[model samples]
Target: MLVSLAIATANQPPNIVFVLADDLGYNDVSYHGSEIQTPNLDKLAIEGVRLENYYVQQVCSPTRSQLLSGRYQIHTGLQHSYIGVAQPNCLPTEIPILPQWLKNVGYATHMVGKWHLGFYKKACLPQNRGFDSFFGYHSGSEDYYTHFRGGYGVSFDDRDHWLGYDFWDNDVPFWSAISNYSVFVFNDRVNQVIDKHNKSKPLFLYLPFQSVHSPLQVPKQYQEPYKNITNNNRRIYAGMTSCMDEAIGNVVEKLKTADLWNNTVFVFSTDNGGQILEGGNNWPLRGWKASYWEGGLRGVGFVHSDLLPSDVRGTINKQLIHVSDWLPTLVNGVAGYPLNYTNLDGFNMWDIINSNKTSPRKELLHNIDPWPYQPKDFNTNMTSAIRVGDWKLLTGTPGANNGQWIAPPGSGITPHLPLTIPGQNVWLFNITADPYEEMELSEKYPTVVKTLLAKLDTYYKDSVPVRYPDDSDQANPALHNGTWAPWE
Candidate 1:
């Protein structure tokens, strides 16, 4: 009985805190060589294991779905696009999610920040989808101050022109705007949750911050630090990032004050590559958000905890991890056992991270049919990609329809600098040998291409059919007619 008690005590799980940044660039954080100052992020990198090759979907909603479900977005009906404001589509209710899995093992799961997956109905909201509590907006983007989604296809005077305010406190509307910046507001709420949480149960806090996205807004104090940046947009962008960094610092300090810092498993990552038009810079990478290039899919990520092996701490991990892997990895880490969940596209990377070894994930089905939601008048085809070992194969043009804009106004940056467009159909590259995709070796390595193509074909066949939410005739009349009706 004593031996069994010891084993059970040893298997107790550590608290988890996941911080997800929205649309942050690969080089945006100072640790990754950006000019912007992200001292808190730098500290996290210095004290944790930095993931060098973390990948996500080229867009938002798909990545979020995969992060929560441990399955490919295509398998979950979130293929290639985000749910527009008031759209009826959302993550299928049948699928199990991360919070539910964690809660099963006595963890209190909470989320604060963006929930862009879906919100057309209460069933699609985060509270109903397993999260015990949620405080944030539900749309793709909203005014930081007004908390309103500017409507589509209508004038400001029109009743349908503006979506209702989006800020929410777990199903109740958060109408009063705090004087503090949105980032700071989120930080305060996180601290409150941490302080008030029941100590008997392990905590799982998911903070998906909406910093450095669109509508570049920041407090004057944050902007003061970036006075040296000559460009207006870049300066504001820098300030926004700084504000988020400071907020993170405050939260970390709170954890320390609550004596939960050392016992917590902390993870920081971005949803996808940065949006170039929003002053996001993915320097030395090929494309921006919405593109299948390295810039769009790759993101910045790191993990820290006392649970991590001492030798692996503060080291760069060259593991090919995907967004879907987090659910299984965290679950396995907390459970102190292998879940081996069925039908999961993600691998439990706990062993790799703990041992400071190469990830067992040898191949990845990165994306498929990425642009299925294109308007009917536009030409759309199956655009997909797969990565095996160091080689990558891309079929169809990944971002042909994406507009050409590298930076916001006053940044003085041309779009797609030193541009070298690939051929229309198939393109192949050894990403390990050519990080920037400078060389094309499809013709030279036909056998390699053939193997990759076969694997890609298998993945495509296994994937569920792509569903276009925008094309659904069953959309609420308000959404179909370009109006915003939260009550609907």
Candidate 2:
């Protein structure tokens, strides 16, 4: 049931604009700790609430899966990155998506960015998946210049035709403009969508920008300002980040111009952690995007909605929340959709968002496939983990773990393959005190390790592993290891 307020201004539900950035780190934004200039995002933090304790899965697919399905990746058979377009492709069609629910409640839904989840045919497109309008690439990253194929100048044009099946808008073939500025193009299209529907009913815009991702190409104008950064990798990355920041500013200005700032809900977040090696700097934290450490899974979260309470209009909440919570939260506040389905891994933070109080999740869950595509010992190189209080326990080394396990090539089919070097030892850390995993206290507290291990074992036994049990799973076979059993 929806809560009611005495002030009955209008029956119109508030608009929601969700903006997602790729490879943006937790502290990379200007408001967090970085020196990057992001006035619009910083202003949003000051006027609304900034969430510091919110978490997501290791890589892109899982976080996206959780965001759309309101369930963990494994629960939806998307345990690994869905590389090629195949069966059990992107997000399953049987399950309902976020936009579909919003459409059911009469809100106008639009997406003007990445839709990498799945798009088998016309029926599996954005139009059929609940969004009324969409204008972006269907696959993963694309060249900013050509928008043809890969992230860098590397092109796969020889294999597939780029112009034939180019852009899409509502299941129809839309215009495709190949330029040296993909980011600017995406932002402009998003503005167009908002302008066309600003006068209509409540609006929902999903903008998944691909600014800070790979290929390391930045517009020369944006790249020139960061020449003083010294580091070549970071210089190009800084350019991308600043350009994205400016693009965000543009969108916010448009919202304010239409007088929709106060009546709309704006959310800014990243799909996963940063890629430190490829121009991302997640300083003061241990690991990068694929690790189970704080650095690997933690990203920025800011929510600015008209429904916020006056006292907490410009507050900060450090409560633990996950990606799965967004669906239910939006459904409750803006979409007014039914929550009949079960097994959603996240809890609604409606009260906490309004009051900035404590949350109820005792422990947040974190898990990934064991042995990425390779087999290794300890299974830490592959599998799920749990975060209780300030401690995080994994099957392998947090720093060495990049969310994927590595084995010798062609070693999976045969058991006689040689083993690889052990990256880091299994252990636990006090995240509150030592945010990095530099100090290990596993030997000091044997009992704590035992208890956490037992809990992790219980969780694995109950979970449905998205992939099969190889040498990694065999090394640590929990109850439901490789078993297709739903949580009871």
Candidate 3:
């Protein structure tokens, strides 16, 4: 009996599996009352702790940078926007990332799908950033079937466009003739990783699925269920999301088969909120992907594990969690400590999560940057937002506009336009009372507005300058050549 107990206890440190959905909205999942069916995600929420107020950056790479470093994106040299494929901008190598921390603790780290952080040089690739294995695309978005960047004036029919193929297996170009939808292909790679994982050692699997992003693509079988949805863009978006849901189901089944289900802590979340242009609906919430509104910053998230106390499971956690929190949470979960690292913007909410207690976090600095990467013609500085308790303040322009729901490609929909303020030039709201941000309360409570603005000013002073402006012409060569090379 003692020998058997030791054998079982050998695998005590739970494996960590983080699943990130690209551009999934608050209302996109079935659990959130969207028409789209996400039974797998719903099941996870039912079996785990659902975070109601989980927040991320308003865009992709910013959130990703914070997620990995546990530092604010501004500190990570990714202050304003996503990294362009050919742009020299990248997550600074000096900062310690989550994978590197986990690796130090004897965990085998593997990343599968969508490494949008940087690819200008091999030094910035995922494998160089402490991931032992990496399999996926390097660009922000790619064709689901062809595995190439779209809308760069590069036709699939053109031979030159083949150079734009972005799929890779650990820095090596994956030019295999295998033609399958990217969602399924990524899932297949994940399954393989799970199957081959060393049972004795802990596994840290970061699976960032390229689902529900632009260039909406899904297999016919996945699309069949959403045929009743009349709108073409929405129908396609639903199908893409459903495909991701099924992929999640497959991963869960794999965990069960491997007997790693109970000993694994699984987290599911989106990088940011939905993009309105890509048929994403964060309805009733103020703004879309690039805006600082709750619709763009607040994301759907849940954590499930048998290790969680029974009382905490199947409960809604109203904690004010940030994307940066994951690094510390997982590091603490695995009983790992980082050396020579003290400052982190994220707080470890494991105690609050497991005990069903209120979050220790009370304030969130949403963002303090100009509009991220818009067309030169429509470029305008976006207002910054800060949330403290129930009070929220917006500086500059809020950029709320009513426009085309499903925006055409390259339409340049400027979401944030300057709101006319009588004297203060700021918008204030009690988010708890008015989640939609319909009513401004700056005039009603001048003191509260003043306090929040002071706090924003402090953050602004410490914030790092933007590393690369979004509208630079440096990426023009790659856009014209239909490929990105480090030497270019």
Where in model 2 is the C-alpha error above 4 Å?
1-9, 82-88, 150-166, 172-175, 198-200, 371-381, 397-425, 467-488
Encode model 2's per-residue lDDT on 91-179: one tens digit a residue. Answer: 77778888887877778999887777755445656667888888876655566766645212112333232222334565544446566
Model 1 — which ten-residue stretch has the worst lDDT? Answer: 372-381
Model 3 ranges with Cα > 4 A deviation: 1-11, 150-163, 334-340, 370-382, 400-424, 469-485
- Poorest lDDT segment (10 consecutive residues) of candidate 2: 468-477
Regions of candidate 1 where Cα sits further than 4 Å from its true position: 1-11, 153-160, 178-180, 337-340, 370-381, 400-423, 471-488
Residue pairs with clashing backbones, model 1: none
Residue pairs with colliding backbones in model 3 are 399-416, 399-417
The residue-by-residue lDDT of candidate 1 on 50-158, one tens digit each, is: 9998898887888888999999865886676677764667788788888888887888889999988876666878889888999887775777776766555222335
Using lDDT as the measure, name the better of candidate 1 and candidate 2: 1
lDDT (CA) for every model shown? 0.76, 0.68, 0.76
Cα lDDT, model 2, residue 415 = 21
Ranking by TM-score: 1, 3, 2
Clashing pairs in 2: 290-402, 290-403, 367-384, 370-382, 372-405, 380-395, 380-396, 461-480
